[model samples]
Structure formats: C-alpha cells, structure tokens
Target: MDRSSDAPPHPAQALPVPAWQGTWRFTLPPIDSSVPQARHAIRDLLRRRAAPLSAERTHGLMLILSELVTNAVRHAALLTPEIGVEVTVDPHWAWVRVEDGHPYRPHALAASPERQRTGGRGLLLVQATAQEAGGSCGVRATAGGGKVIWAVLPLDRPTGRPATSPPPRSAP
Candidate 1:
C-alpha cells in the first residue's frame, strides 16, 4: 500500500473520510525506551484521532510496531542510532512501518514445534499475526540503504465478523 490517505478505498467499503486519515511519522534514538514510547505514542495518536480500527486490530498493530522497534534497538542500534516510525490510515486500511539504517534484511523464521527458544521469533509472530488478520508484511530497502519493515491491515475485520470472534468454522 502507498501508506497515504489518498490511496484508493477498499471496494466493499464506502466509508466517510475519518478524522484519522493521514500519515504520521516519528524519529527516535534506538534505545530500549523507544520501544514503549513509540507504541504508546501511536496508540495515543490513533485514539485521539478516533481511528475506526477495532481494539483487536489496534492491539495487533501495536505488537507489530513493538517488535519492529525492539529489533531495531537490539540489532541496529550501533549502526543506526536513530529509528524511524510511520503510521498511516485511510478509510479502508492502516499501515505501520519501522525503519533503521542497517543493511541486513531479516526474514521471519518459519513456525515449528521443535524449535524451543524464548527469543528471535519476533518477526515470525509479526508475520503470523498479520496473516491471520488478512494483512501482509515485508521488508523493503530504503533509498538511504536502510531497510523498512512494514505491515498493512484493513481497518475493518476481513472476515465480515467482529474482531474478537474466531474465524468461521468449516463444515465437516
């Protein structure tokens, strides 16, 4: 997605222009504190703007943002002293991106039962959460030689159901 409010609306929704329809950006020094700060700020911005996202969607987005910022702090702090965060929402979708000046592009590890570890699975969780919510995520190289990890999700639930409800059951 373009991460701009001007992006086209989803075909099914004819939503009116929301108060939160715009792109917002932030730059923070890569540090442990920046993780929560970034998440909180984004949360507050969305709430203050009265974003149409459901609580579940907002929470999922926050988790993705936290993981991205925490990764940047842990892995890229030395090379990239600053981290960039961006949030954008239109009537149909919401986008979150975290950028750092590291050249390495990390991939989400595949989920498995045998792998026993407490850490190094942030990206995997990010991918799974996004996919479950009918969204997509990936990394892209920035013009400055850095990488931006991003996720884009719909403003409304994709399954035509409430966000907190389970996906419809399949017939036997």
Candidate 2:
C-alpha cells in the first residue's frame, strides 16, 4: 500500500487557500499538528490580502492562533468533527476568530511565573496581545453549543509599540 496517500501533509503544504480580500475561513481536523498549519494559514491570508503587519503584531498573531487552536484540539472528538478558523480584515483592523466544540467560560486565573511554567498562560498572553494592538479579546457561546474566542487587532497600530497609528501620509 502507498503510505504517502495516508500521511498528513507537511506544515508548509497544509493549505493553498484562494486569495480573498475580506475574509478567509478554514476547517481543519482537530489534531495537534493542525496548530502550526493554522498559524501559517493566517500569515498567508494576511500577506495575500496586501495587509502589512508589524513584526511584533506578526509574532502576536502566531502565539494567539497556536494557543486557541491547541485548546480546541484538546476538546475535539468524533462529535466535534472539525475546528474552524476565521480571519477577517478591514481598513483599520484584523480579527481572528476560532470556533471550538465547547462552551464559553468567563473566569480565568491571573498568570504568574509559577503558573506559566505549568502551561496555563494561553489566555493571559492572548488578552495581552489584543490590548497591545489597541484591540480587545472576547469569548462567547455559539447558538449551536460551541464557543468562539476572538481577538481584534488594530491594523494601523505602530510596529514599534507606539501609542498611536502612524500619521496619515500627506498628499504629494
């Protein structure tokens, strides 16, 4: 039997999404390996749309997507089937939404050095990244019983972590 046909794709070969301007959505099998693929997909989506992200923001997006997708994979099963990742962008912001097969919860513990060593800092980092980009993080229960955790990042925010968007370019 040809085993190549049965193997999962290498991370770089994970997706070839059509170029889209406003939004791109993906449904990946709920497995651990999907995490990196998800990150690459989002990065490709941003680049294909001609949206330039600061290096800091790029790093933030990778961390947030990895954390969110890893959490969803933990809760996935036959009943769940798939996990959804959505990337949407507008003139001023880029938003990432991950839909999981679980319900939303409001409470989260503050992350500390000790706690982080044990691997519980996902949401803490996510929320911090959102705020750092002049945006917000939120969670809500979907009508179908799953949960969606999202972060909205400002597109115009400075790459150097400055307090405001770059000044508008003056007309030539």
Candidate 3:
C-alpha cells in the first residue's frame, strides 16, 4: 500500500551533445508591416542552423515566408489582435505558419481575369517558390480552430557533382 512503490520508474536519461540540433520557433505579433521582419528572422534562423543555403535559396525562403505571412494577415485580419505568426526551422526544412482565430482553410487564388483583378497572388507565389526550391507547399486546418499555410524547402544542395580539380593547366 506504499504510495512511493506505486509510482512508475524514471526513464533513462540521454546525454546531450555539444552540437546544436533542434527546431527553433518564433512567435511574432501580428503587425501591419511584418514582412521585412519575418524575412530577417527566417534568414537568421537558417544561418544559425548552418543550413547549406545559397543566396538565391535564402532569398526564396524570405519571399515565401513573406507571402505566407502576408496572406495570413490579409485573410485573417479580423483574427489578428489575438493571433500571431509562427516560424520554425529544423535541420531538413523551414516552415512558416500563421495562427488565427478562424477555422477557414486556405485556398489557392485562381488566375482568372476576375480573380487576378483583385491582385491576390500570395498563395500562387508560395506554391511556385516552393516548387522551384525542390520542395512542396500546402495548407491545413489546425486542431485548435485555425489554418496553417506552410512551405518546405529541401536542405540538400542542388544536383550536379561537386567540382573536381581544375583541368590540367596549360604550360605557362
């Protein structure tokens, strides 16, 4: 009948490594002008993780993040005061998610003349950029009553063998 005896045994502990490896999450207040800040944060996170990213890839990430955040801001404007954006970067990919109070799923903007007339192209940009980076993008409703528009970029370097020794130099 001893209470201490009824408790489960503690689990074994795992040693921590000196190297840094884990997901980094950031929550930003919904600001009217947060695109720039979002880009900066994503860049910093990627750099800190030592991601093998090039300048072009970095710019792509920034653009995608900006677009996603902007879409969330625009579509979920009414949910902003109580909502925020979350950006996460892991070893293999980076993600940006906007949390709102609404439960609507994000739909890609059509390219019809009427749909295009309104100038709503954020989702299109996200899909194209993600595809260009050898990645994929999509949206899903969260269990907590909101939706997340996310894009994943592969960390692997582009195809093509690394450069070997230069061709034999011509006689000087």
Q: Pick the candidate with the highest lDDT.
A: 1
Q: Compose the digit string of candidate 2's lDDT tens values, residues 47-91.
A: 666675777887787788888888788754444678999987655
What residue runs in model 3 are displaced by over 4 Å at the alpha carbon? 1-21, 82-84, 87-91, 113-118, 158-172
- Worst 10 contiguous positions by lDDT, candidate 1: 163-172
List the RMSD of every prediction in angstroms: 9.8, 15.6, 13.4
Positional deviation of residue 164's Cα in model 1 after best superposition, in angstroms: 20
**C-alpha lDDT values of all predictions:** 0.84, 0.72, 0.63
User: In each prediction, how many residue pairs overlap at the backbone (N, C-alpha, C within less than 3 A)?
Assistant: 0, 0, 0
Error of 2 at 13 (Å): 40
What is the clash tally of candidate 1? 0
Question: Which candidate has the highest TM-score of all?
Answer: 1
* Candidate 2: Cα lDDT at 9: 88
Error of 3 at 20 (Å): 6.7
Q: Candidate 3, which ten residues in sequence have the lowest lDDT sum?
A: 163-172
Steric clash count of candidate 2: 0
Q: Which 10 consecutive positions of candidate 2 have the poorest summed lDDT? A: 163-172
Deviation in Å, model 2, residue 147 alpha carbon: 0.5
Encode model 1's per-residue lDDT on 97-165: one tens digit a residue: 899999999998875789777788899998888888777788888899988988877787332343443
lDDT of 3 at 25: 54
